[model samples]
Target: MTIFEATGAAGEQNIWGIVLPFVLMFAVFYFLLIRPQQKKSKQRTAMLNQIKKGDKITTIGGLHGTVVELTDDTVVIRVNDTTKMTFERSAVNTIVSSAPAVAADK
Candidate 1:
């Protein structure tokens, strides 16, 4: 009788054995994957809202140019003094400085 009762108590205590692993996995995923992704998305949104004419930016396709115009959903980027291309606002990957890079002496 004592042995049987002890086995039943063990089963009850181990009820959480199945659930605890899943809960720990979810917490790990949230911290390692989901939380940083959400933070990056928020920063991207803020950058998009701050876009303005003449800002140098890089696109997701790796094109770098200066912003010439902005619309509700599109931007006109000047690739050169005489050439410009339009892209969706979401295509911008990052902003770059318009200042010319200092050349290194050979």
Candidate 2:
């Protein structure tokens, strides 16, 4: 057998040595990081898509307001009777309330 072919044949026997580490590392990251992030992203997308007028929301930047209008890709939120800000629908982080807040723990 030629020298290159002999070496390659030997190397093939240890292929798992090279590939297993990468596979294991990817598994660790998938469970610890990637999977949870994907879940949160899906939930966030669903929440954003379901937004409607009069729902209280907080933006990713922590601006709290009530949704006054919604469009395909943007939102108009009223911070006060005469104050409003327009933002991308994705800028919203969470819904705070749809009704007045009351403490359930107290």
Candidate 3:
């Protein structure tokens, strides 16, 4: 092959070599960071959706309470015997404990 032809082939290889690292970096980031974050977000959303009355929970702000009420976008938590507070459902950090199921005395 001519020198020009060899240079052209090397140029094409260099372009790919430059792009490959960026592509691999994106793949690594997706798997190690973005994908896991998305999975965690989905799990958190499911947890929030599953909240119900009597379930004990903690908020992101460190408040502990029992779930007293629920709406699409909000929750009412009973923090004490006489004090209940409302918060966005997303504010719940985790479910501390699920409510005990009651069986009917048939």
Best-to-worst lDDT order: 3, 2, 1
lDDT string for model 1 (1-106, tens) is 6999999988987988878999999999999999999999999999988888878999999999999899989999999989999999999999886545547999
Write the residue-wise lDDT of candidate 2 on 1-106 in tens digits.
8999999988987897899999999999999999999999999889998888889999999999999899999999999999999999989999998744445895
The TM-score obtained by model 3 is: 0.88
- List lDDT for all candidates, in order: 0.91, 0.92, 0.97
**Of candidates 3 and 2, the better by TM-score:** 3
Among residues 3 or more apart in sequence or in different chains, the pairs in candidate 1 whose N, CA or C atoms overlap within 3 Å are none
TM-scores of the models, in the given order? 0.79, 0.76, 0.88
Off by over 4 Å in 2: 1-12, 99-106
Task: Please give the range of 10 consecutive residues that has the lowest summed lDDT in model 2.
Answer: 97-106
- lDDT of candidate 3 over 1-106, digit per residue (tens): 9999999999999999999999999999999999999999999989999999999999999999999999999999999999999999999999999999868899
TM-score of 1: 0.79
Candidate 3 accuracy as lDDT:
0.97
Q: RMSD, model 3, all Cα superposed?
A: 2.0
* Backbone clashes in model 3: 0
Quote the lDDT for 82 in model 3: 100
